[model samples]
Target chain A: MTAKIALSDVHKSFGTKAVLRGVNLQVETGQSLVVIGGSGSGKSVMLKSILGLLTPDSGSIKIDGRETVGLARRGRADIDHQVGMLFQNGALFDSLPVWKNVAFRAIQNDGMNESDARDLAVDALKRVELGPELLDLSPAALSGGMHKRVGLARAIASKPEIIFFDEPTTGLDPIMTDVINHLIRNCVQELGSTTVTITHDMTSVRAIADKTALLYKGEIIWQGTTDELEGSDDPFLNQFINGLAHGPIEVEGQKLDSAASPIEAV
Target chain B: MTFLATIGTFFLAFFEQSGRLSVFVGQTLAAMLRPPIYFRIIGQQIIRIGYFSLPVVALTSFFTGGALAIQIYYGGNQFNSEAIVSSIVALGITRELGPVLGGLMVAGRVSAAIAAEIGTMRVTEQIDALTTLSTNPHKYLVAPRVIAATICMPVLALVADIIGIFGGFVVGTQSFGFNAAIYVQRTINFLSVDDVTSGLIKAAVFGFIIAIMGCYNGYYSKGGAQGVGRATTNAVVSASILILAANYLMTALLFSA
Candidate 1:
């Protein structure tokens, strides 16, 4: 399968602190890939690097086989037009009504008229099961889950060919998280678009990810199909999957002293 | 070595930030004349940046003019030239202090508020949301503010000039035993078209500086609430200092001829 997005030996640093150290990854067309990592592990930085929000210190980023590193402002905007993003916090504009927020790109960039944009926005909202009456309300009035749905609706409003989700289920209840997961899967399936999701929610990974990659210390340590993940024998993967405090990944580097020491005879 | 490096870093950051500000200004100016002008938004900003700011500017100008009249009276008495009070008062307030001081006062009040509001929106990802929805933030947010301030400050300065002159008139006629008509004639006589025009021109530039500083500081703010607060404070301080410094330079240039 041809890869739709690819990163080879990407490196980025802020000051003396290196965040992404020669990271490499690929996502094929019409597939979902989820990257899992601990906090402060550069997952967000890596996503930002791909989106051209942060410049990589070295290496290549290719979108649809076109080199995107070192792109100018206009070039980056062109790239942004081809991709949709759902930020972690929903990030809806408070000054604008919900419909306006959903229709922003279409009206501003595409030059769609107000009535047409409103119609499209309402349609997009319906896809997320939101009612037409909610269109005139501000984002601040919505609950957290509703806000995320509106954000997702706005992300897909432009009919983008590729989507990036940044920690989509960070602070949601379990049922809401599953609802979001289902919506994401249904939307991507309907569009057949390529997707890259960065998340630590294992449930989200299980429901939405076709392929999973484990990121550690700015590198992809493991990647495979979800089925392969269940049967993998790697010790690090074992410790991480079971959420164990012992094993090769120690708790603050104190070894797990076995209870089978020789002094038990007495 | 460390001190020298720190100074170098400061200069580097300053230049870098100034460059970004220039780019932002250029972008806003470019979008100002484009179609789909948000007249409603501009009207709202005019109310915020110009109309709501009147009482403070007027009050400050009034006190400043009154004080200048008293000082000139006391100082001019040394040469038995206390009769020049009206001319001196009019010249001092209209030609130099009225617009510049008024601009600085508005900068402190309006610029800081704008920076804090926009900076909070930015750190919360509202700006990103705008971009994702295909809105040009420069066009939507910054342009209305720049245009509104540019138009409003001149009007505010005009009001300040009138109020300041009236303040000088009240003190001169009531306390100094000067004839009201004579004082008004001397004040009018001393004032030239150039004086009023120069002050208005300075007001427009100061307005631009204030709005630009506010938008730049707020748009680039990071971290969150603490970062937004710092940006607001920095925007006010930097804009005020720049206005005062620019006033001196403009005065030197405008009056040199």
Candidate 2:
């Protein structure tokens, strides 16, 4: 299968602080790839670089077989029209009502009439299981879970072929996170859209990701199917999955207390 | 030695910041007149930046004009030449104080608000969200504000000019022993279209500068809440300084002939 998105040797830095260092990844068409990483592990930066928000110091980013690294504003807009993003925070426009926020891409970018855009917005919101009454309310009025659902509705309003979800379930309750995960799965399945989700939520990875890649420090250190992650005996994967305080990965400035404990038979 | 170095570093940083501000202003001007006007957003901002600001600008000008009449009377009384009160008040209000003070007042009120709003949006990832949705933040946010301010400030200045002249007339007639009819006539006689037009033109430029500075500072804001606060402060301070400085420059240019 041809890759829907591809990145090779991506490198980026903010002043003297390096973020992404020779990172590489690929996503096949209609596949969902979840990038798991710690905070500040450059996952967001990678997604932004793909979106042309930041020009990488060096790399090749290809979307649908076309190089997208250095696209101009018009070119970037052309690509942007084909892609949708769900930001970590809902990031809805506070000045606009929920319907307007959902239909923003349709009205502003696609040039749809107001009535048509509102209708589409209501339809999209309904798809995310939001009530029609919520459409007139401002996004500031919505709960955190509801806001994410509205953000999701907006992301899919254009029926884009590609979607990027950044930390989709970071701050939600477990039940709400599950609902979002289910919604994400169903949306991708229904639309047959390729997706890249960046999250630290392992549950979300298991629920939504077709493939899982572990980003460490600035590079993808391990990548395999979700089953592989569950079954793998890799020390890094073991330490992270098991949630052990004492392991190969050290939390800075903290002593490994278990290391001082007596050796116990496993 | 370290104190001297710190002073040098501060100047260097100031120049660097000034250079960046210039670039942002240039970009704003370039993007302002481009196609695909967002009329809805511009109308919304006109209401926010101009109509909502009317009370403050009007109040400021009225009091300033009343004060000027008193001051001019006291100064002129020294030479028994209080006859020029109406002419001086008319000239001062229409030619200088109306536009400059009105612009400064609006800048303090509107520019800081715009900067804080946009800066908060920037830090919250909302601006990035706009880009991902294929909405140009410049076209969607900044251009509308700049256009609204540019169009509305002159209207505000016109109201200010009228109110200011009325204030002077009231003060002159009541406190300074000038006949109401004579004071109004003398004020009208001293004022020309060129004087009013010059003030209006300066108001327009000041409005543009204020909005542009606010939007630019907010758009590039980083870090977090502290960063947004700094952006808001910079927006108000810079817009105020630029408005005052530009007022003088435009006055010099307009009056040179």
lDDT of 1 by residue, A122-142 (tens): 999988889888889999999
| Per-residue lDDT of model 1, residues B114-222, tens digit only | 8998998899877766655445678788888888989999899999999998888888888888899999999888899988999999999999889888988999889
Clashing pairs in 2: none
lDDT of each structure? Answer: 0.86, 0.90
RMSD of 1: 4.0
- Candidate whose TM-score is highest: 2
Q: Which stretches of candidate 1 lie over 4 Å from their true place?
A: A246-266, B1-43, B77-82, B173-179
DockQ of predictions, in order shown:
0.53, 0.86
lDDT of 2 by residue, B5-103 (tens): 999999999999889878876766766878778998899999999999999999999999999999999999999989999999888998899999999
Model 2: residues with Cα > 4 Å off, grouped in runs: A250-266, B1-8
Docking class of 2: high
